[model samples]
Target: MNGVSEVFSTILLTSIFLALVFMLLPFSYYTIMGSVAKTEYEYVKHGFYSIATYFPMIATGGEYSIDFPSQYTSRGYIETGRIDIYLNSSSQPTLSFPCMALTQGASVGGAPRGLLYGVDTYIVNDSRMIPRIYEYRDGNGLMIMTLDTCRLLLDVNIVPTGNYSGYYYVLTYYNLTISFRGSGSLRIEPVRMYTVYSNIGGNLWNITIVVSDYILGKSFSYSVIDLVKMGFGKEYAGIPFSLTIVVEELVVEV
Candidate 1:
């Protein structure tokens, strides 16, 4: 109290000393620490967002797996499992994906060359492309390729109602969640048979099939044809042609 001027001078000296210390610090050290902390924060935020958005997409993938049977084993675990992995690479993944198939002369050496990218699906209203097919092996070991022949038994191809060919058109599309209904043990692989022939009743024709699976048509329903058209209203007793039918996620027309 006796020396007000001296007290002001002492406070000013202390403040100047603190400012000088801050200025003398190495700028790089602060810069490095700040960058690291910022990166960490951003990573955590983006990770959370990705997790939320991707969960729905994975669910969509599962909905299509509903056809598998019960009691399967995987990864040393004796439990039913479903796989939904997101990928854009060539690596064979741990995810159990269903076999994707296309028509003849496209797939070679067990790999399919397709015209479109990403998930392949068909919609009926899209008249530009034909409908997809679903051919399950029949008792006679034939892939039934006539699903649309008798769809509702109305006036259509193969009149008077016939067995459904494995081929069909998806009347609509579903962007909804993909949910799989699984059952039997599920395994996936790629297999190809270049040319196969049938000798029924001494009939001769060239038959070729390409499939990608450990066990092709093991659980499928098939049908054998005694008579098939050879074009121009001429049918053959045994006309061997490579055939394929792929069952896909379908939504009925409203």
Candidate 2:
């Protein structure tokens, strides 16, 4: 009878142990998955920050590359993403391009948040009444004057002349948007850049910078006169002038 009692006690203990493991299984799995997702999110965010911080360099038609992990978690995968550039206080974007990012499996902390970078405003003072047409590359188009911290690309067929001219200074206002996605690694480069000029008023002009790529198929615009007020004249010490709106699409390869 004692041997039978001992056998029963061993069976009961084994049952309890198995039940405890089953109860903890889900908690352990979720905890591990959450940690993994967070780490993946951080990696993507860092890649975006690097692109934003060195955007000027990349804008000069250079290649920027980053490693994009295929999966955030066992179930989460990357989808389409994009980057947008807003100049000044305008509600619309002056420049935009396609990017990639994770878009599924919300149970594992959802997708990463988008990134925003504020660009400093600089006054570009050109002594000539007609803005100097910088050097034109063999095939790259016109390379505009480089600011204190950034370079601008503009393609102009009609250069301002006569009364519509004076010492001009352009106020630089810009911002950036970055998103992510894909498997293995990715390379981003500017495929094309061009600008169109329109005479909106006597002294005020509309400049549109258009960038195009495979994934981008939209256009957006905003006026500079609404953001900052200034006059144009050779008599004034440093008259603010010229509104530049940039629209761009880029090639991103995996």
Candidate 3:
């Protein structure tokens, strides 16, 4: 009986020791990887032209890919080059890889993609004054199709570990993640010279690109949709709202 008891105790001790070692192995591995991640700071170089860096948000659905805009490239446009990467997961894994680009300049209209966190106001569909009726207080029936045309006020770029501030709209809209195949041609250019404002100087929001040979014979048209206004609900819906838009149309525009 004593021999039997001694054998069982030896086996229990051995099992516990092995289990401890197994649990610790993974923790040590991740620690090593985290150390390597710190190097992300070593290469950050501030400039007028920057390749887009995407700190992906956890897909929450499935594996997907998004592109970075080339407006921040050398000359406010990148024909092609390296882009910062991040997965929309706790993985926080990052990569720098080569890519093609969609037009340039600050995002104005078209399919909403990538990290669109802070955007103030944008016109939905067209700013054209169409007639759509809304029953507001019975006799007070109103037309919503025509209101102060909420133009593309602004879409602040997302940065790594940086906080950007802008008006938050709880508007109902489409937020899209798209995939395209086959070579095609698309061009995005920003026209009209203008100035806007932020929390800082009222004169701070201005488009300062110097044009060599550009012309504005007369007027322009508005086709971009306002995702923020689309997301608007009863009084901004209790603050801290997200301006996530749906892809009413699925062609990516930057």
The prediction achieving the highest TM-score against the true structure is: 2
Each prediction's Cα RMSD?
21.7, 13.1, 23.3
lDDT tens readout by residue for model 1, 1-254 = 65997899998999999888788666766666555544543333233233223423422342111122111111111111122221223244322324322211110122222222111221122222222223233344322221110110001122122553221111111211112223232222112222121122232222211112221212211112211321112344323322222222322110
Residue 129 in model 1: lDDT: 24
Between 2 and 3, whose lDDT is larger? 2
TM-score of candidate 1 on Cα atoms, chains taken together: 0.17
lDDT of 1: 0.26
Which residues of candidate 2, in runs, are more than 4 Å off? 73-107, 110-183, 200-248
Write candidate 2's Cα lDDT for 211-248 as tens digits.
22111233333233322332322233333354443434
Best by lDDT: 2
Q: What is the per-residue lDDT of model 3 for residues 182-251, given as tens digits with 9 covering 90 to 100?
A: 2232212212222221122222212121111111112222111222223343333222222322111112
Pairs in clash, predicted candidate 2: 81-99, 94-246, 100-180, 100-181, 101-180, 101-181, 211-247, 211-248, 211-249
RMSD of 1: 21.7
Error of 2 at 66 (Å): 1.1
How much is 32 displaced in model 1, in angstroms?
Answer: 11
- The stretch of ten residues in a row with the least summed lDDT in candidate 1 is 147-156
For candidate 3, give the lDDT of residue 148.
13
